[model samples]
Target chain A: MSNRSHATQERILAAAETLILGRGFSSTGIDEIVDAAAITKSGFFYHYADKNEMARALVKRYLEKDNQVFTDLFARADSLSEDPLQQLLIFLHLFAETMTRMEMTHPGCLVVTFTYERYQADEQVADMVRQGVLTWRQLIAQRLATIAEIYPPRLEVDLEELADMFTTVVEGGILLTRVFDHNKHLGRQVLLYRNFLRMIFSPDPSR
Target chain B: MSNRSHATQERILAAAETLILGRGFSSTGIDEIVDAAAITKSGFFYHYADKNEMARALVKRYLEKDNQVFTDLFARADSLSEDPLQQLLIFLHLFAETMTRMEMTHPGCLVVTFTYERYQADEQVADMVRQGVLTWRQLIAQRLATIAEIYPPRLEVDLEELADMFTTVVEGGILLTRVFDHNKHLGRQVLLYRNFLRMIFSPDPSR
Candidate 1:
């Protein structure tokens, strides 16, 4: 695709995601998305074969965006510290800070939005969302396993569960902050997770 | 209300919630709910004045049911142990075990369901969901405050944030388990929270 077309596709996807996040997939009409994107119907059809294709593209776009963020944060954390445990902790702090930096309650996650309306998507769309979550799990679990090898945790923490706890905290944090309209709760949850990690790994174990 | 009418009402509500959770509020039609409930259109109307009223009623019903379960579990935990920290831990275990007891992936919480589709709901519906989450936060914080008085958390945990962590864990756990079709993750996440609590408290430092 041309750069202009690519940019338009991104704009359309962003509008779709924002609408779907607030309402749902099935209820978010194509015309509404086109209007929001300031694109013509022909422009939308040129980019997506159908609603299913659009949904798939949205999931793909979201996952790639999320993966980029994760990779960037982890890379920055890795450069800052040698210890795998500290690196993971630093990564979470960075991630949480990003949440705190959001001007509004974080837009709810795309994979989570898809998960709730799985019945509306085709098998391909479902697979994209499932893979999106798996990707997150693997990324966190890899760091956690590295930490497990280095620190020998103060608790019998399952690496997978530990990794998932981060995902849960973010997802749950989004829900809490959105529901209560309190943006700080997301940061607090992240810090709470950080506090838990500190208590588990810090040699002195003093706050 | 007559027992028969009450039972039919439950049937309609159950069908509506199940459908709504799978798809979403706007996508789920009244006819689909009636068909699922195995009731006629008149029967559904008899139970609920309209779809809006049904949505309101469902939120009210779900919050009450949830409040009842949380209260019962905490009361049971309090009775089981003298230590406030221990009581809270026990409550999570029971809660996790309860998640395991479900034969299927959780249906998801009604408050959370409404949250994703808040734009579609009336102000009253939105208020109920907001209130529902607040109630959960208050309930969990009350217990954590009790624990704080006794334990003086070593990590300087915010009682409200710590309590919100439980909400996040469960909400996150439900999302993970449901997305993966694995019932165990929910219990495992709960246990992870339990483990975090243990690390935060307990006079013994043993892993």
Candidate 2:
């Protein structure tokens, strides 16, 4: 694809994602996407053979972006602190800050939007979402495991479930934010999860 | 309404909730709902004037059922303990147990389903969802307030946000459960939230 064509595909995907997030995958049509992208039907067909292909492409792009964000945040957090637990906490703080700052532009997670409409999604799309969730689990659980090696948790906890809490809080936060139209809900929830981590792993009981 | 007609309405609402929860509101057609309910198209129309009315009715019925469950669980927890904190803890424990037992039959939350497809929902439906979330917040926040009075939290915390965590965990847990196809996720997440509460409110720092 030429530079111009690639740009057109990017625009198409962006438009599709916005529409799908607002309504849902089943309700968003190719015509609306093409119109929003300022492209023709042929242009859409050129980029995606069918709606299923487009859906697959959309999820693939979404997961890649998410992976990059997590990677960047963790790298930044590591640079700020050598302690694994502190790194994780710093990452959560940074993430909460980012969510608060992006409230205006944050359309919401496509994976979640698609999950609610999974009955309409093909197996490949479903698999991508599942893998995306697992990727998050792995990323956070690794840090928790390292922390556990140094500071055994005061309470008996499942490392994996605790890791999953990061995703769970974010997902639930987004839902509350959207429903309540309060951007701070996401940030506050993350901070609450951060506090939970502190209470669990901090050496000083008072702290 | 006659007894038979009221039963028909109940059937239509039940079928509509399942279909909407699966594929979303925009994708689910009246024909499909009627077919699922084993009723005629006229029968559906007789009960609901249009899809919007049906959506409203579905949400209303879902919220009532949820309210009843919480009420019953809290009542049971109260009978089990006099301490506000203990009652709250027991309520969460019972809730997790209920979720685990109902894994096979739990079709997922309709309020969440509608929130995802809010663009396709009318104002009334949206208000209903917003109110349902607030109700949860109020219910949980009341308990937390009572607990805080008895045992001032060691950490600085917002009672409302703390209350909101209950809804947040359950909502996020349901999402994980659906995506992972593991019923255990929801129950485990709830238990984790319960643990967090223990950490936040327990008088014994060691405990």
Candidate 3:
């Protein structure tokens, strides 16, 4: 793709992501993205064949951006805290801060909110969402594995299960936050997660 | 309300609930509910001042129905399994079954899917969803309290936390299931829930 064409495509994806996050996938249209990007209909199709293609690009680009964004928080968390347990808690808090800001403007997750709509109507789009979540799951699992390595006695812990719980709870918290229009519910979720981690990491009571 | 009118109104509410679940609130219309119920538009207005009013009725009715449904399942689970941990596992199993069926018909929560849309446009409907979730949280908290009382060395797990986690995971599982259009993700969620409960109940290995 030419440099100009690539810039136009980037503009189109950026606009679509904002719209999809705000209005949801079904309610948003390609024309709206094109309009938001200040590009014509012909220009929109040159970048994306259709709305589905745009959605796929949006998911892929969003995931890449998020991965880079969170990596800084994770590294800061690790550098600032010597204890793995503390690092985990701080990492989660930072994640929530970034997440809340993103959601303050958009009430819900694009992947989550659109997942159900595509599940029955469009298989390829649905697969993108599924893969996105699995990618999220893998990231969490890696963190858990690191924690388990640091705390060898925590043999009872299953990193995969913990990762799943983390992902689910985060998504759940987002849903509640949007539904109630309050960040308190999401904060409560963070508190609950921290407590769960405490249970696993604290010196065994019998020790 | 007259007996005939009450019956017609109930039918309309049920039809609205199913349609809202299947197509989402924004995509569904008052006319569709009337058509589904075989009632006239005038009758719909007589029963419910507007779509929001009908949504309120559906949420209230769903809460009542859910209470009865869960209570019956809990009673059966308690009778079949004397162990508190076993009861928790059984509950997860039952949750999975209900979720799978709901996905076959509609992939997201009627309150959640619509609440995201209406939260921006209608405060009245947003409060309706908040009330619905608060009622559910109370019901689930009570059940978790009862289970906590029976667990050994209980450590006094937080009932509110458990309820929040339960609610969160199910919603997340629904998101995953919808994204994948598969039952395995939900099944995995049930398994993870079972493990989490067992962790709370099982004897501390160090002990």
Winning model by DockQ:
2
Clashing pairs in 3: none
Query: TM-scores across all candidates?
Result: 0.93, 0.96, 0.74
The reply for model 3, stretches above 4 Å from the true place, is A1-12, A29-49, A77-90, A105-107, A145-158, A201-207, B1-20, B27-60, B71-107, B142-162, B184-207
Error of 1 at B172 (Å): 0.6
Candidate number of the best TM-score: 2
Q: Write down the lDDT of every candidate, Cα atoms only.
A: 0.80, 0.86, 0.72
Better of 1 and 2 by lDDT: 2
Tens digit per residue, CA lDDT, model 3, A50-104: 7777777787787777678778888989999888777888888887777777666
- For each candidate, report what fraction of the true interface contacts it reproduces: 0.65, 0.60, 0.48
- Count residue pairs with overlapping backbones in model 1: 0
In candidate 3 the C-alpha lDDT for residue A86 amounts to: 78
The regions of model 2 sitting more than 4 angstroms off are B205-207
The residue pairs that clash in candidate 1, if any, are none
* lDDT of residue B178 for candidate 2: 82
Tens-place lDDT per residue, model 1, B1-207, is 499988888898889988888777877889999999998998888777788898988899988988898889989998999988889889989988887775265456667667766535478898898888788878878877777777767677667777889888888887777677667877889898888777666666574
On a 0 to 1 DockQ scale, where is model 3?
0.41
Model 2: how far is A180 from its true place, Å?
0.6
